[model samples]
Target chain A: MTRTSTLSPVPPADAAAEPTRVAVSTVIFTLRRLPGSETASVALPLVRRTRDPHEGLWALPGGWLDATEGLDAAASRTLAETTGLAPSYLEQLYAFGAVDRSPSRVVSIVYWALIRPDEIADASDENVQWFDAASLPGLAFDHNQIVDYALWRLRNKVGYSRIAHGLLADEFTLAELREVYEAILGRRLDPANFRRQVENSGTLIPTDRFRTGSHRPARLYRYNQDVELADRGPLDRRQ
Target chain B: MTRTSTLSPVPPADAAAEPTRVAVSTVIFTLRRLPGSETASVALPLVRRTRDPHEGLWALPGGWLDATEGLDAAASRTLAETTGLAPSYLEQLYAFGAVDRSPSRVVSIVYWALIRPDEIADASDENVQWFDAASLPGLAFDHNQIVDYALWRLRNKVGYSRIAHGLLADEFTLAELREVYEAILGRRLDPANFRRQVENSGTLIPTDRFRTGSHRPARLYRYNQDVELADRGPLDRRQ
Candidate 1:
């Protein structure tokens, strides 16, 4: 994705004496079925900070941005460190740079990701743990607000993108897919409307597999990889 | 809008000896009626750099991220320095942080803006000049590519948001509004369909004003101020 065009060549400014440092953080979202419950909800991984201004509190998994690495590389590194998996779906959420966000001035280029259920199988690590995004307690820094924005984005993107693939298994029945939306949106959708919308989107590929239930079995479908996971426009092709 | 939630309280990482610096830049869009042409086109302001590296080459207006300023403040400062006006219809576009983007390690937090026609009246300056977004010359650094991405965002946003308010005047006839869309989209939209879509959107408030010409008078419509300029979700309320 390296290009002469997007590659900037302007001279750097005179460095500030007490220069602002950059940090890369992530809000990686996944869906977890509540213990002893049939319903699922949006969840994310957070690392209990070994040390902090707010010590012992959970924080989004991230590390300092190395001068030698690009922002995306730094984010992917953070993901691997926490999840032990390659980045499946990732996008920059925002750059949080309040002068007082931290005791020292640090700007966090935050990213949000969606890890499919299959991808979450090997993400176990002692330091990092998954928490329901809706029920988080006092988190480090402005993390609580950050998670809310990320959830809003995830829910909003689901409306227009085939990003459910990033949360669901490789194959899912329409009912199962609807559950993903219902969880994020916190409400039920008309089953018939949901079917027509995804059908018209043309991103679903019907599969022979079927889920046998107490009633009639429902055929499964997977996302068409050829169709874009989402329309990020130029960012998609450049990356 | 300040909440204790989004603020980070974690201790800062060991500062790199030579830390990556953050710079702010913006691509501000407006409609310009090219000389001898009735149709307008999407355009933006660029300032000629006075210092070396890309000296004399036009670049997106920006400056160093002051140690005490937040990312939004820095972006708004850049916008003010460029246009001498308060930030209008601005959004963080992307954070470009390629290691080799500059000779020095610089991470640029870029923003894109839309300036209404009436707002462009006072944006006259010698160092800064407007360039057609489609036909930008080899700009300073990655500005050519940056502008392309900004324009892509502008076009994509136009399809789903009432951001047309940011480019159009206080009250405009349907024909005038359609021109703004055609200019950004670079193609003609069916008038009947455009009318039906916008009318159904219910974001327009019919005004007593009308544009009388050779054709029958056309009623003018203004955006419903109560309606948001665009659905930015959580960021709108937070800001």
Candidate 2:
């Protein structure tokens, strides 16, 4: 390998003045199953930055990572700071560092989180709102790239894992769960096949509680307490 | 949320004199099948850092990102600088920012790349050597975390995609391919079922050439040039 002086010397004085800093940001998503729509749509929470750098522009809710905090703690903290909502589950998504990504020397470790839409009845702050994946405003920095990658992972992993359930309450009806999948997938699925697949996966357990509404009573189900799918295997390919 | 200023800002005069700055490093990996191994083991090319902080430590070949370089570019540049390797497929893995991770403020954005091992070998430099995943040394920083995630992803993703082929020669035998899978999965698979699954997935195309060995001529197989599996769905199921 050719050794360059560039790699040998310590970083310059200006570099030291603004030493590279660590931050944690997140793309929190929930599937909104819109009735009468062709398919459910994916929505992500965004906060308009109240400070500079990309002040006034929309971006994922995140901020500086605390030195004593772990990655997961930082993510939850940032989310709560901007959205006033606590995500139940979070996973490391990707890290964003392009030299000029920020005017300041900042590199952010991005995480993806899933939340149920009903849990967020309304925007707690004016700066925060859910934007449909298809119609998003200009995002600050390389956040657009982070959102794209998170969407790609979600779409690709849903087949093997029952990720759709995360976008819903602990107990939900079959139709409600199906709608969550359809929203993220952006296509209508055969109701029968979708139910069969979920059932076969053995990740969901039926409950006696039923959803009572306009037409008829629908059976309710909750995630299987005994089986923790994330710890099981690579893709959770049970069904 | 309550805001607190925990750390005092660095004095401007002292900041100018500090030569070294903190930055993150990355060690992207992909599976590579070698001639000697019983099966294809996870192989990553490592380069010895010649500078302080980790002067002689054998580390994943990476370095400081320019203030203008994105995290992705820094990773790509590190791979090119140390190993003369460029991967067509690369994705951000994770960030390691434990305060003690680096003597300097370097918090690395590790990436994972999937490519045919042949490509890496052909691009090999004097400083680079491929090490089996199961048998690796104590790496420079939190690289062990990055490697662990990559291995976990390989073990998880190979079931759905033709990821093993990314580690093999363009033309390979079924036995060679199976070894790659077994090495990553860490288990013995029924060869008959494995073959059946690969064929049924429709990701492999049979080539006209055959490899003549001690027993018989093994038919050569190549990755299907066309079928790209669409992203599966959301990743937030159990959460």
Candidate 3:
């Protein structure tokens, strides 16, 4: 494309700046059982950048968006290519386009995804490593801020939506479910309060199956299939 | 820039497709009083396109994003340029990048803004016009879908956050505040129930001033300065 075609809307004075490029990145979160800890914690995989603009620093798994693909498709592609894992739940988080975010003029359309522990496949490699979302090191670009925002969104969504089901199995005891919430919230919740709240929410369906634990025999529950995991409005159809 | 620089991350075959351009657009919603109506309706300004690709059709006020500007800055700049109105609240809504959304490969970082009825400025011109957001005609590109999502978000957010205050003035009666909610919700709310809910939320501060109406004088109230209009997570710092 000539300078006049794509750059027509931009004035000649502003045209001297490089054209803005688009990139797709994903903050994939999952429940990981940390060593010496019974409760799970939120964790995400990061790719160590080999090139400048913060070489050797960990960054979100992403790549430049291919013009032929849609934004959602690009997010999924880049995530799978970089992390070698496919997430169960993915949603667009935000578009970060701070001029100083990267060396080049680029806009990153960041997506946050949720992976069920059962589906996490071969995530850690030589260049890729999983880090606790809360205790992440200095990441490349503005990724630390991005991860914080994603974690906030995850915790916020868990309160009103049925998103916590993405972290658990098809059927689990209430205690297990409570653990997921406690992990994401980073605090212990009153078991009685958690049970009453989940029951009132009406998103859970109690199953006849039971899990016999050391404390007591607990009933297993599954998410109501009729209800969506999260309400993403009209754009959820693509997902 | 060489073909290997910005487009390097994309494969040679994928790079054959045109490099995507970033554009910033805003759905600036404001409450406008209609003729022969007591309550206001949600309305937004649209610019009539004068070039090909849905020429003569109405579209959201926007322009191609300049690389030198950040996403938020571009949104504010393009919004002010296309529509001569500055809004009270503006937040990033979503990033729309469906391959078929436009004739050219364009990814629009859409923002939804709220304008208080008092701060609305001269908005009508030969090319730009305000249309009822609920009953908009066929718009250019994928703007109709974008507007629907924004309206959905506005309604959903009002249920949880104090964002409805953005559409209100500094001080208002319970009846006036209810009208703003009723207008955006497109339905009447129980007056007593609405009062009890907002009061219980602890976000309002009753003032000495009152609105003397035909029925009874109702006390006015202002938003609690300590509470933010909306909880935008860490990104709230930017706004």
In order, what lDDT does every prediction score? 0.75, 0.67, 0.78
Report the TM-score of candidate 3, chain B only.
Answer: 0.90
Best-fitting candidate, measured by lDDT?
3
lDDT by residue for model 3 (B16-108), tens: 344578888889888888989977899988888877777778899888887677877777777777776677557888999988888778889
Candidate 3 on A101-154: residue-level lDDT in tens?
A: 888877899998777878876644678888998899998888898998898888
Candidate 3 lDDT at A210 equals: 96
Q: Tell me, what's the RMSD of every candidate?
A: 5.4, 5.9, 4.1
Q: What residue runs in model 3 are displaced by over 4 Å at the alpha carbon?
A: A1-17, B1-17, B159-164
C-alpha RMSD over true interface residues, each candidate: 9.2, 7.0, 7.0
What is the C-alpha lDDT profile of model 2 across A128-191, one tens digit per residue?
Answer: 7788986788898777777877888777665423464567677888888887777777778898
Residue B40 in candidate 1, Cα distance off native in Å:
0.5
Docking class of 2: acceptable
Question: Which docking category, incorrect, acceptable, medium or high, applies to candidate 1?
Answer: acceptable
Top candidate (DockQ): 3
- In angstroms, the error of model 3 at B89 is 3.1
**Each model's DockQ score:** 0.31, 0.28, 0.38
- Give the poorly placed runs of model 2, Cα more than 4 Å off: A1-10, A17-21, A31-41, A99-105, A121-124, A159-165, A226-239, B1-40, B49-55, B114-129, B159-165, B228-239
Provide the TM-score for each candidate, comma-separated.
Answer: 0.90, 0.80, 0.92
Candidate 1 Cα errors over 4 Å, as ranges: A1-15, A122-124, A159-161, A236-239, B1-15, B121-124, B159-161, B236-239
Clashes of 3: 0
Cα lDDT tens digits, model 2, B12-67, are 34333432233434454556556685555667777766666566666776777666
Highest TM-score model number: 3
